[model samples]
Target: MRADRLVSLVLLLRQRGQLTADVLARELEVSTRTVLRDIEALSAAGVPVYAERGRHGGFSLLPGFRTELTGLNHDEALALLTAGSGRGERVFGLGSALASAMRKVVDALPESHLTAANDAAQRFLFDPETDLLSRRLDVEEVPKETMVEVRQAVLAGHKLRLRYASRGQAPRRCVVDPIGLVTVRDKGYLLATEAGTDRTFRMSRVLEAYELPEPAQRPDNVDLERVWAERCAQFLSEGHIAVQVRVNPARRDQLLDMAEAVRAETPDADGWLRLEVTFQDLWHAEWAMWQLDTDAESLAPPELRSALHQRARAVADRYRDRP
Candidate 1:
């Protein structure tokens, strides 16, 4: 919820006129380092925030710059604030805008509820980088220049040229009529059409992108949710290799991360967990299972079991003698 934290930082400055980084950090429930970074982000976004160094000096906005948005109830403000932190500011290319809008939302609240609303919003966390077990979600990174180009084409209804890299494939050049962008679980996908056929490209794998001058050839109205659901359905119906596994409960998340789906689950007599999982193909299944090491054992699909056995033997043979 860095977005909402930024809003709170601005609100604190706006309320107190000027406050030192220590006070800002204390009030915002973050460190002084974080406060300084938020200040930089605000200034880069043209927020007119300025810092005065020395005793009795701190950060303040330029005179005559403030939002006049008001009349929002505490609950409404709370909802907006929660959304800001939940979706985060990185969606699409509007991180700055989201922070600015959330600031306005914070400012609109009655002074009595402003602090309470922000505190409440801070309670609900979503899609944080670290999970309960301290395992990190490897958030995908999309290049800024490439994302900007692809986002522009989608918004402007222009065709886009991309040096794209798909899974397990070499990067290649292609042009697609842009439809829209979709972000799920911190990963972004650019949904478009290549030669009148629907296509979805992971934004991270876009090595390079350029907004084309020509307009896109798209339907009159695009329902992104419907199109995405249909594509997901198509993928689900396609062939997948299903393998049953008994895995240590502790590494269950690691196993599920690489699986396409979980079809069944149960606990074994010895306290291990048994489950049926699907992978993209046999190779994928083998690779996924191998990553778990001894934490998982394949129970079905003779081909997968044989492949795992062969892989283990190959490794054993390589290290048959100590290095």
Candidate 2:
């Protein structure tokens, strides 16, 4: 850990040119005394670190010295910059580290390619609070402490005890053998097992988390992508409501994209495309169909159609009575 911290200190100085002990302490999550000691240690080890004494004075390396640690090219630097813009870092509690690393990456770039790469990177944006259609992005709330504990357990292969509150269900205590953590659409989940049964728990729903001292009982080499895929398949299959819908051909692609497990059937005689899709439940189906407005019609599971009708009628009644 000290070795890593020392390396990070060198890289930080190399990236920023000059920084005060206070700034270094804050960035490295250590004390000013520790920063001073590390600075002395770096100098003793022939790192050429020097300190300037004044309000604006700080620690700096000899002029024209670079760390030679990161060798990112133009495109690679831009890719790292773009990834740093994502929300995953915030969920994983690496926001500050990512910011510091990005600064180093930008500073490490060749001057000739720096400005152009930075400008080109501005063309791509990610996870804007509001999308093009004026719909707000969904950002799940996960407690920082909870996320940190869960992440530590998953990475260290330790057992985790969590007080989970599933929707519409009372909070329950469970001990899990964590396999990995996954983030999808800005939401985080822990792919784990309880009593040898597979379970996926949303980080948002974790009311409390504690890492156990015992090592987790999990596969030696787990494939997180494969596990996530299997979990998704199971989630879509269990207690899911299949809805048959007829959509205008022009809007067929939109409907399919919005719905899960979509299967295209022959177009109806009226030239509308028929599709069968599965939704997590009735409310899930209703919400999805609601987004299509009038472009798609739900045709099956009479209850779903009735639910939509009632919702539309309720909206119409509200406006009808307003006048």
Candidate 3:
């Protein structure tokens, strides 16, 4: 702990050139007394650091002992020091980490811009959702530390023991060699190889993760990005549910203009539109059909189409009986 403070202190003094004890303690998360002890340690190690005691006095290295940080311009320095406060805390974990690192950058800033860095850090913020579709889904019940370790294992090319809960079953355990980590919106995925087969484990679905003694080995000649894309394609393809609908050319054109893909022959001569698209297992297809009304006609996929007609007929029958 003392060593950590000492190292951070040296780094601080070298980059900052001069800093008040109060400021160093605040940045280092230690007391002024602790910072003083650290300064003494640095001095003992012949670091050429010294302290001043008066009101305007603080710590500064002897002349010719100052070290400067590399390659940070004024705006860049300000941006780095306070880049996360504006983004409400739930965006990217790595972004949060970078924000913490930015504080260190602020500490390293030249005295002339210290005030600006402090001001910027307090005001800088970003929202990841502005560019992403935010959705909430069931995730595994694992601790953040466990997830961090699992991610590190994937990066380190290590095998992991995963206790996962399946969609409709109790928790099952499996051993997997992690190859990559994927962030699909709010979901976290660990792309791995199990028994020579590629598998993806969702982090939120994981109940437990254990690092195995087997050194992590990456798969040979495998392109993880390609594999992940293929998996996503397959997932989308599996959801293909056909729906046929009747809509006038005016409506069909409007739909097409809106980028909704139309399936089968588009002419529909009679103003009917046939379209098929992928949908998740959880769907409100019938309700959506009802909402679309006469503008949408379910043409193919006999089961859903027939059901739609029957429901319409039933509604008519109910009206007739009521009259």
Candidate 4:
């Protein structure tokens, strides 16, 4: 870990030219005393580093000093660049560090590989602001202070006290042991436990967070993927509506795309597709069916069919008066 910190220290100086001991300490997540010790170690190892002694003095590297990094080929360099697309970085409070590391990675590549790799990587875009339909993507705003405290607690194995604001409920204070942080579809959630029960808290709903001094009450090793999957399955099982529908051939794929689960799919006698779909609730089913217009017909659920019929009649009545 110290080796990695030393390497990062060198990279920071190489990229930014000069930084004070306090700045270096904060960036490296170490104390100012530790930073000074690392500076001494670097100088002892023949690195061209020196400190200026004045009110505005700090640490600096000798002019034209650059450390050579290896182990990354042309494609690998480009892959690293493409992966750091700047989306989801702010959730964990690593936006600035990611940007700086990207710059260092680009600089470390060979001269022959730099231009070609950058050109190839520029052709790929990740998490664009707008979709193909020209609709703007929704990005949740989480307070930076809250995100930092939550992340620190998780990484340092400490307990957290959260002021959580659930929908239709007043803010409540709860103490939780943070198991991990999961990001789904550009949204962040804190997977934690309270009183030996698993719970998921959306980062957006966290009104305030405080890191407690006590260690987290959790197992040493956790399978985050399994936990997330179990939570998702439990969520889908409760408060969901199952609807059977016959969709026209042209819109069958669109209907499937809108559904969370497709229990069965078969071709009907009239060449239409019969799909057993699951939605979050009745409103979700109705909105999805409305998007399909006449291409979809609700077959089994009489209540859903009635609701759609009523909506159609109301629309027709309003238009008739206009004409």
Candidate 5:
């Protein structure tokens, strides 16, 4: 290692009260002269490293010096790098910007920790996939400009004028006070407070949005986490399908991993696990059943089972019609 680089490493260890020139030289794979030069560089840069020469001697930092997030051990460095990658676009916002920040953090870590950090990255990957038999719950990416404005408005306690579209009606305009934003697997949504009542809006339903000039007067006691839970409960009550499935016990994890909102039930004597999953809609439930093939059976909610049967018959009917 270069003299300057070795010096930086020594200072990092010394800040943690683990400073020994001989140990730092071995750690850096360099000689004592290189280590000494590094100590000089640190002194030049105003990082205090006091050395005591004797049988019990090492090094220590100057008293009363504190730096936020410094002197990270190997595990701490690995954890920080791993957490940075998973934040992706929500906390960091999408694309190259988040990737650049992650790269900078990884670059700052010691060379010895690089392999562990790389392994951590490789172990976790983000991919969102839905089964073919399930109705595709399509989610649109909120424009980056809109996302930024929404975040700011929510933080600044401002109201927003939004153009919204429902499934069966033409787009309409309304003014709402921004509450918070929630990000599900691949989807993002906004929760807004209305003048008369509290309600949440999906960002995907927004056709257009503009920050209103009026002040946002929301209740000071507004609990965002509670609001999120309430909205989720409402979605499950009206927009969800209650699906019960009898699954082979060995295939439980595989099936649960494939579907969202799946709750495993007690296993029967036959070792088959029963499951109840909340589907976005009936079509989504039916599609998930199709993905499991014969390994699972949809029990409750006759409509879902019937839909699955009808879809299977249609495939057979197509071939029959060909003749």
Candidate 6:
């Protein structure tokens, strides 16, 4: 492990030219003292590493220093190819690029590991868009150019002029600072800030986008995963309607997904589950229960139960005469 970390330290300096000890330690997940010791060791070993004192100075290597450690191992190559194969259909308009990269990876693998990696990669299949019933998940499709534009703005750290489609309203135009792009379950979302307020936009609802020359106003040290988690938690904490239900054990996972939180649970004698769950709203609660069909029963908030009853009755009445 020390050997690998040393090699990584060299690679980072080579690729990025110069870095402070604190930055290097953070990148390598080590202490600043450890980074200093590594630097001394590399210098003693004639690697031409040197440090400069005072603020605005860190560590650097003599220009043109290089290493020969760019090859990916069999497992790494296989992981890339497998991910490429699975996400080929939704790669932000980079399907061709991914295919070309995969080919290069396969060609670079050693003869001994080639066949085994290929077989391993082919054994796993991922197609989340198609459910067990063979029904395709309904998702809005974003134009390739729109996705590309949003990506460029985010990468370039530039302001973006966006025309967005809001539900039940006309498409509105606004200028926002593009922070990042993320894909969840094949659906894309852009996290940005509008007028200094955090906002998240569905990529498919983006009618058009133009990258601006002006730079975006955002913090330099942004942790995207942390930001995304915070946004998700905030969204999940509001506007929930609590209810109780009795459902088949088999559909517990589906119920959990629909509910914001599960407050309590009790196992029924007949193997059904009685759960106190909170859904986003009355309509949402009704919709999820209806989908469970005979396998579940909604048991609280007379209004939700009443809505479900009316919906079920309407369906039964429609089929009473048998088409």
Candidate that would win on lDDT: 4
Model 2, residue 125: what's the lDDT?
A: 83
Please tell me which model should have the higher lDDT, number 2 or number 4: 4
Provide the lowest-lDDT 10-residue window in model 3. Answer: 131-140
Tell me model 4's lDDT, rounded to 2 decimals.
0.86
| Sequence-dependent TM-score of model 2 | 0.79
Best by TM-score: 2
What local lDDT does model 1 show for residue 32? 94
For each candidate, what TM-score against the reference? 0.73, 0.79, 0.57, 0.75, 0.61, 0.69
- Per-residue lDDT of 112-164 in model 4, one digit per residue for the tens? 67778889888989788776657565677888889989999999999999999
The TM-score of predicted model 1 comes to 0.73
Candidate 1 regions exceeding 4 Å error are 1-70, 236-240, 247-251, 263-275, 291-295, 311-323
Q: lDDT tens digits, residues 1-323, model 6? A: 67666767776776577899999998777899999999988888899888888898889988877533247677876777678776565656665445444545554566557677778888878666676757576565788888878989999999999999975699999999988888876778899999999998988889999999999998876888989888777666676788999999998877886677787999999999999998879998999898898999988989999999899899889889865
Q: Which window of 10 residues has the lowest lDDT sum in candidate 1?
A: 63-72
Candidate 5 per-residue C-alpha lDDT over 88-162 given as tens digits, one digit per residue, 9 for 90 to 100: 445413443454445445545555676676776677654433444454544466777677667778778789988
Model 5 accuracy (lDDT, Cα): 0.69
Where model 2 places Cα greater than 4 Å from the true spot, the runs are 31-33, 43-59, 69-74, 100-116, 126-129, 247-273, 321-323
Candidates sorted by lDDT, best first:
4, 1, 2, 6, 5, 3
Cα lDDT computed for each candidate against the true fold: 0.85, 0.84, 0.65, 0.86, 0.69, 0.81
Estimate the TM-score for candidate 3: 0.57
Better of 4 and 6 by TM-score: 4
